[model samples]
Target: MKYSIISILLSLITLFFSIKINLETLIDYLSTDGKSQAFHGLIELKYLYKYYFLILSFLSSLFLVFAFKINELKPFKHSAAFILILGIVSVFTAFWKWFI
Candidate 1:
């Protein structure tokens, strides 16, 4: 249950950062659409998600550790359990996008 809450918080934080990065990327892309520069804006965008990958992977690993040691979320618990699954899915989905 705690892991689920933590996961949701982390995921939300990541999402907020993701939106900011995306906006920056969009601006960069538009600003450089016609003019040629020494550094390509798209290149910057390409590597921007690396930090998120590291963050989410580290978080997921930490969740696994604590889940096994302390959480032990049961599948049938319903309320918190459902929240936990939702949190996990959101984290994994964001992580997956950053992954590839």
Candidate 2:
């Protein structure tokens, strides 16, 4: 319960930052002949991080819903299980990145 709340809170924080980041700077980075390639590359990396964070956050919300509906085992249970597993795997993948 507490972990879910903290996860949601952190996901929301990441989402907020993700939405605020500018995409044009990232687009510019992908342009091979751009003047600010180095700086723009850094910005692009941040942009990707922001987007992945947002995706993870989104997935986390789905996992929360799955967790909430875990007991029913009627209609949403299968979906919930699938989502729950997916969430676990995703978090593991994210952890690997963090650790490495």
Candidate 3:
């Protein structure tokens, strides 16, 4: 039960990192000219956020596995699995932006 709760929480956190871009970053990125160093920096930061998504996805996957094996986690098993799958898909579909 506790494992499931933690798994669900971590899965959500991973999903959050996958999609949590602020308007300020976009505004800054759009406002800067292509030749500006700030433009490159902002782009780099956005890619860095994706790196976090990968790391968290890995951790969340582990928790989901543990939770899935436990009988006590029956109530939350589906939700935990679903959210974790969503987080992973966020990474795979980054180029396509299929589901942010």
Candidate 4:
């Protein structure tokens, strides 16, 4: 149960960072000119960081789900479900950016 709570917390952290990086990327993309100068260091970092966070979020969410299932604690089940949904949404958002 403790591990599951920790995993959910980590997932939330990852989600936060992922969203932050995404917003920064969008702002940079919209503000930049047609020049390739925008693809420099920080932009590359943001791109890579977002994916890292997304991956972290997925792993943590998985851990939480597994732990919660093993414990079968009704109290935390709702929270676990919410985090799982959040993780799925984050995964979709991350992939959407890559594909589109």
Candidate 5:
């Protein structure tokens, strides 16, 4: 019960950060002149953010696993998993933007 609540809270926090990163990315993209390596660099950064979020989410899953298996520290595992999934999706979207 406690673990579930904690997971939800952590997930919310992770979501907040994810959105923050996205907004910042958008602002950065808009601020840049649409030309040259700067564009590429921004795209790359976007890709990187996806990967980073995915990893963090995965880590959150691991935290949940640890909480369950260890029976102590269970608060963050599910949150991590959720974040990982979100990151995976974000990456996919970014790839689509890049390729098409």
Candidate 6:
């Protein structure tokens, strides 16, 4: 139960950070001039956010596995798994954006 609660808290924190970074990137993108063609700046931000997403994914996965193994947080097990999956998808999307 304790571990599950801790994992949930950590997942929430990771989510908060992820949202913050995404908003910052969006704001930067919107503020820039389309005619300026600031591709380089976007590329840099993409990489930066990609790594941040990766970190979130890692932390989420770690806690998710722990929660699964302990099997004590039955009520929250599914929620934790969902967060882990979402984090992974975000990481992949970030990487895809960087590559493309």
RMSD of each: 6.5, 9.0, 4.3, 4.8, 5.5, 4.4
lDDT of each: 0.51, 0.48, 0.66, 0.64, 0.53, 0.61
Best by TM-score: 6
Assess candidate 5 and give its lDDT. Answer: 0.53
* Clash pairs (backbone) in predicted model 2: none
Candidate 6 accuracy as TM-score: 0.68
Best by lDDT: 3
The order by descending TM-score is: 6, 3, 4, 5, 1, 2
lDDT of 3 by residue, 1-100 (tens): 7777787788788677656543334455556686874455546455555656677667777777787666654668788888888878765554322222
Show pairs that collide, candidate 1: none
Per-prediction TM-score, please? 0.49, 0.33, 0.64, 0.60, 0.50, 0.68
**Residue 30 shift from truth in candidate 3, angstroms:** 4.3
Model 6 residue 41 CA deviation (Å) reads 5.7
| Weakest 10 consecutive residues of candidate 6 by summed lDDT | 91-100
Model 6 Cα lDDT, one tens digit per residue, 22-80: 65566555566765445745544554644565665666667667878877757787877
* Model 4, span 11-34: residue lDDT tens: 677667656766666666666666
Q: Which stretches of candidate 6 lie over 4 Å from their true place?
A: 37-43, 46-53, 91-100
| Residue 89 miss distance in model 2 (angstroms) | 22
Off by over 4 Å in 1: 37-53, 68-100
CA shift at 14, candidate 4, in angstroms? 1.4
| lDDT, candidate 1, 1-100, per-residue tens | 6765565455556555555555555455556645643465445646455365447535844664565567466542233334444444543343322432
lDDT of 2 by residue, 1-100 (tens): 5335544555555544443454344344455464676465454564454445546656666656654654443334444444444443443342322321
Clash pairs detected, candidate 6: none
